[model samples]
Every structure is written in C-alpha cells, then in structure tokens.
Target chain A: MLPTLPLGPFIFPTAGLVIIFGAWFCLWVIEKAALRLQLDAQATYTLAVVGLFAGFLGARLAFVALHWPAYQQNLIGILWPLTSGYAPLGGLATGIVAAFFYGRARQLPFAATLDALTPGLILGLMVISLADFLGGPGYGTLTAVPWGLSQYGVRRHPVQLYELLAGALTLLVWWRLVRGRRYDGQLFLTAVAVYSATRLFLDAFRDNTWIITNGYHGWQLVAFAALLLSLLLLARHDGNQ
Target chain B: MLRTRFEWVILIIVATLLGSAWIMMSQEPATAGSSLLTLAEAPIVGHPAPNFTLPGTVGQEVSLHDLAGQPVVLNFWATWCAPCRVEMPAFQQASVQYNGRAAIIGINQGEAAKNVTDFGAEYRITYPLLLDTDQQISRLYEVRGLPTTLFIDADGVVREVVIGAITPAVLQDRIERLLAEAGNP
Candidate 1:
C-alpha cells in the first residue's frame, strides 16, 4: 500500500489526501440527501461541520484528561495539535450530543435528520475503507481467492473492497426506495440493517478485526446487535405505518 | 406478522454466523500476529525489530540487539522537522523517566552529526542519538516520514508504529504499554 505520495519534491500522506476529498464528497452527499428529505441542506451541512469540530476538541480534551499528569509540566503542549493522542470514544459521544443539540435547535425532525444522514454515513464508510486499503491497518485474513489484494505478504482478502461494495449497494437501495417511504426513518433503519449484516459477514474475513474473548470478533458482535436493533426498529416502524 | 418476519431474518443471520465460526473466524489468537508484519521481513508490528548498527552521534556504534530483554523506542527524526523538534524534549524526558527499564534511541535521518550535536545541546537531549547519515536504517524500517516512532517490546517485537509528532502523553502511554507487554510493569 502506498502510504505517501511524492509529487514535486513534497510527500503527502495518502490517507490525509483521501480524507480531504472524502469529507467534501460526504458533505455534498449529505446536502443532496437533505434536500431530498425536505430538510434544509445548508442547516444539515452546518450541523455536520459543528459535529466534526466538537468531536475534534472532545477527542483532544479526552486525551488530556486521561494523561493529565503528563500534561501538567508542559501546559502549552495541550494546545499542540500535531501529536497523536486522542480518545475515539470521547469524540464519538460528543459528536452525537452536539449533532443532536444542533438538530433540535434548528427544529429539524430527529428521524428525518437521520434519514438525511444515511447516504452520507455510507459515503464516509466507503472513504474510510478506501483510505484503509491505501494506507492500511484494515487488511483482511488470508485468502486464495482470485481477487485477493496483497498486503503483508501472501494473497489476502480484499475486505475494503467488500466494504465499499456493501456501501454502494445500500446507497443504491436507499436512493431507489427512499421516496414515499412507509415512515420517516425507514430508509435509515433499512440501511443500518443491511450494513450490519454485511459487516458481520466481512469482519469474519478481516485479519486485524478487534477480537473479544471466546472467539468473538468485537465488530461482529456489535454488527449483530446493530442488525437486530435496526431490524426491530424497521419492523416496528413498518407495522405502525 | 411483520415483526415475526424480521425476527426470523435476525435468527437466520445469527445461525449463519454461529455456524461459520467453527470453520474460520477472526477470533482465533493464532491468526493474530504483528498486524504490520504481513510483509515479509518488514520491521512492522509482530516482527523482530530489524537489526542494524549505526554510529552514535557522539562516538559508539549502537545495535538494536544491545537493548535485548528491555523495551526499546526507535525514534526516526530529522533536525529540520518542527514536529520532531517539539517531541524531542518529551523523548528526552521519557528516556530519563524509564531509563534502564527501556532503551530510547534517536536515529537522526540524513543530517550531519555537527548539526544534530548542536540541536541536542540546545534541546538538552541526553538519549543516545545514532546517525542514519544515508538513511539506511529508516529505509529498512520503511519510515517514509520523519518523526516516526516505533515501540518495541522486550522480546524485540515491534509493538506500535506512530507517525507524526508524538506528545508526551502519547509517548508515555506507548512506553507504558511496551513495558506492560514486556511484563516488566
């Protein structure tokens, strides 16, 4: 995998480049989906932008909190943003909270907002999968399949491709059937259910998936739970409709 | 009926995964080796730290194996990289804190020893700084960017590879993880 690209004597991290483009593309997707869902596209974009900023600050603060002792001596180091020190869980929690508040303040319907985000979410996942494929840590288990992409050494499963394919399929399904849906959040729930199923299948083939005790892939378990929850919500919504 | 149908779908997926777990699964500990060591002989996680002896900025030639039975941190840095400069103090501080328990070595990338010596003096960096004048060591380690740091456990297995500037907090956390993995802490 090419981690860095050398163009005109300056080397740029491939992941950084991909993410810059991916963020823009994902926002574009959210804006378009927002219009389709009859929500304010600009407002949705602003909510996402705020969520990202809050998530970044939350992640940095969480790291400082965890390693407070280390930062006591170098007080200015807390403001230094170059170093790698972040708590992802903190970022995720804060992002959700911030997004929720923004949506409410703007008088956006919760389920409708979620529906607007489904395609953008899928696009984000696809971008991450692509970045992982290029600058790794997302390679898959060994495989003898003809389409296997090489990573460590021997032929390995192209799990990123599998993920991208799944995202594309879900997005297609959403775009096609989202119109006049039975309920407001039906499309989001359906997409999540489908994504969770694919993830459960794909994580089994991934080499570096987070694993829990007793032969359980951590993501597989999470995906299973997500799949169940999404299906249940979708069923409830469909029945109510 | 609709709920029942969805429940059935859930049950089928659960059953399929449960059955497939027997054949091949990601949870098997044996399959979990250095995530980065999939490439043959690459100095990635789960692989032995590649062996190389480089001339220390001061005088002595330092070999990675010299730090055997102790955690080792190999910091690939350049004098010109600002992030590298920012983190050098933290590395110096950590080397003193975890001295003897861990070996923290700085490999200067393609810089003249005089410049490094001056920089070290300015920063008061006391760690053994080895010179990679030709960047052979960095190339071997596949370090594309400066300010890359590799944390190796006592067994000499590369545990973590961090690119970009490393804060004191992150540096401490990684070193602690290395010590814990090495069973010294």
Candidate 2:
C-alpha cells in the first residue's frame, strides 16, 4: 500500500491528498449540476463549502473531545500532533446538519438542491473508495480468487474496488434518472436508494465491518434503513406526480 | 446548452473510468504477488536496518546505528496488543541471557511514554524501550502486525523477521544464530 507519497524532501499522506482532490471535484460537479438544472448555483456552492468545513471541524473537535483528558494533561500533544482520530459518523452527521442549515438560510429548495448534489456525492464516495484501496483501510475478507489482493500475508477480496464499482454504477443510475425527469426530488432519492442498496449487498465482502451478534453488520443495517427511507420518499413523490 | 451538459456528463464519466483504471493498474502489480514473495521483496531482511534516533523510556535518545558491534533485536510492539503482552516475558528473559553480546530494543508503536514505561516496569523488562510517537520507524519497516521482531547482526544487516508471539526458546534460537553469524563474519 502506498501510505505516503514523497516529493523531494516532503512527504504527504496519499489518502489525505485523494480526499482533498475529491472534495474539490465534488464542488465542481455540484456547480455544473446546479447550472444544468437552472438552480441558484452560487448559493449551492456556498452551501457545499460550508458543509465541508463543518464536517472537517466537527470530526476533529469530536475526536479531541473524546480524548479530552489526555489533551488536558498535555496541551502540546493536542496542539501539535494531527493523528488519525477523526470519527466518520460524526463528520457525516455534521455535514448533513450543516447542509440543512445552509439550505434553510439561503431559502433554497431542499429536494432540488439535493438532486443537484447527488452526482458529486457519488463521485466523492468513488474517490474515497479508491483512497481506501490504496491506503489499506476497510480491507476485504480472505478469498482464494485469482483477483484477490494480498494484504497482511493473505489473499483477500478487493472490497474497496467493489465499492468504487458500486459508486460508478450508482452514478450511472443517477444520470439516467436525471435525463428522464419524473419529480423534483426523484433523482436524489433514486441515487440514495441505488447507493444504499449497493452498500447493503457489497458490505458483506468487507472484513472490517462491525458485526453485531447474529452475523449482521452495523453498516448493512444502516444501509437498509437508508434504502427504505429513500424508496419511501420516491414512492410518495410518484404518488404526487 | 443541453448538448454542452451532455458533453460534461460524458467527460465526467470518462474521467472516472480513467481514474479507476489508473488506480487499479498501479495497485494490482504491487499487491498481486504471493504473500511470501512480497515479504521477501520487502526492504527489511538482508538489508541494513533503517537507522533512527528515538527517545527511550529512560530519558535518553537511542540510535540504532550507535550500537554497531552488537546484535540488535528490534521488536515493534504496542502496550495494548495481547500478543505483545504474551511475548514480553520471553524478550525480557532473552535480554538478560545475552547481556553484553546482544541488545534487545523494544520499539513501542505510537503510545505515550508513561504508558510504555508503566508496562515495561510491570513486565520487569530490563531492555531499552523506545517510543515511536509518530510511528515513522514502523512505517519505514513496513511492519503490518504487532510484535514484529527483526534480528539484526553486528554488521546491521537484518537476518530474521518474526511475527506474532514468540517463545523464550525461539528467541534464544534466533539470537544464537545472529551471534554465530556476527562472530563468523
């Protein structure tokens, strides 16, 4: 795994580079989608920027709070070192909340705004999956298949690639939904449903998923709930149409 | 304008495909080889141990290159690893058994110095325990698992790499071979 990329006297974490690039691409995609939909592109861009900052700050602050006692003892440790302690759930929660507030403050249509953002979100996920594959996180279960990638002295299924393929397919589905317009929020709901269903199916191959008792993964349950919610929204919107 | 939108969509899709292809091509060859072959090709064994100066638990900077004439057992471990806990006593025994001839250096991976010192004292470990705060040395060694032991001869060439919990007999056996190699060389 290429954990760090070295460029003549400086080394940067490859995953951080991928995430930053992905965020930039995500913002660009959202702007183009907003323009295509004849929506307020400037407001959407502002909201995306706000959401990204909130997510990053929220994740870092949550990590610091969790290790508050340690930081309290050594202020230098808290100030100087940037360790891998950010929580993904905290970041996701903060990003969603920040986007909601930004939309409300800008007087933007929530459904249409989300529809414009779907492609960027899927593409961002695709980039993150690629980063995970390269940086050796969320590794797959042991497999004897010819395509298995060697990790920790064992041939394992490349689940990160599976997630990337799933993200690509979801993006295609979103593209089709956008082309064949039905309702205001149809594209966004369908995108979420496709992505969630993909996660529900592909997460089984992941070795590091948190498994509850009875052989069920926590992420699989979350994906199922998200898929259900999206389908319900789609159904409600179809009835209105 | 509609045609331009379609073109943008096509461009995005094509870029995504190209990016995925590039990532796969770059990663597959490096990780596709057999695990044993990958371990062999790793820049660890048969190469000189990467030199680093780290703060030891005893308030001194310990550098691997400074201890030139003695066989060094560099074990990368963590205080919380169960296998590391199981193997500590064995390493402690081996340290005393080969007092002047070999050096047993325990490199704790990314833990506070206080915790490592407490654990070392609890285990009655007499060897020097160094703190790899940023885990730079661990990354340099490509140590994927805990309790990874590298036996370096007097010439600083890494001779053997042992993963997982090690017994006193096994540690002694490897140290004996390392000492033998050093003397003959």
Candidate topping lDDT: 1
Fnat per candidate, as a fraction, reads 0.41, 0.01
In candidate 1, what are the lDDT values of residues A1-241, reduced to their tens digit? 7777778877777877897799889888999999988888999988887887788789889989999999999888888754468898898889889999999899988888889988988898899899887865566777889999754467888898899999998898888877757778888988998888888788888866777776578888888778778866676665566
Candidate 1, residues B28-138: lDDT per residue as tens digits?
A: 665455444544555765457789999987799999888899999999999899889878988999999998899999999999999999999999989999999998899
For model 1, name the residue pairs that clash. Answer: A152-B38, A152-B39, B34-B46
* Superposed model 2: Cα runs more than 4 Å off: A75-79, B1-127, B130-140, B143-185
- What is candidate 2's TM-score for chain B alone? 0.75
Top model by TM-score, which number? 1
Clashes of each: 3, 0
Q: Which stretches in model 1 have alpha-carbon errors above 4 Å?
A: B1-25, B29-39, B45-47
Candidate 2 lDDT, A180-222, residue by residue in tens:
8766787888888789878877777776566655445777777
**RMSD of candidate 1 to true structure, Å:** 3.0
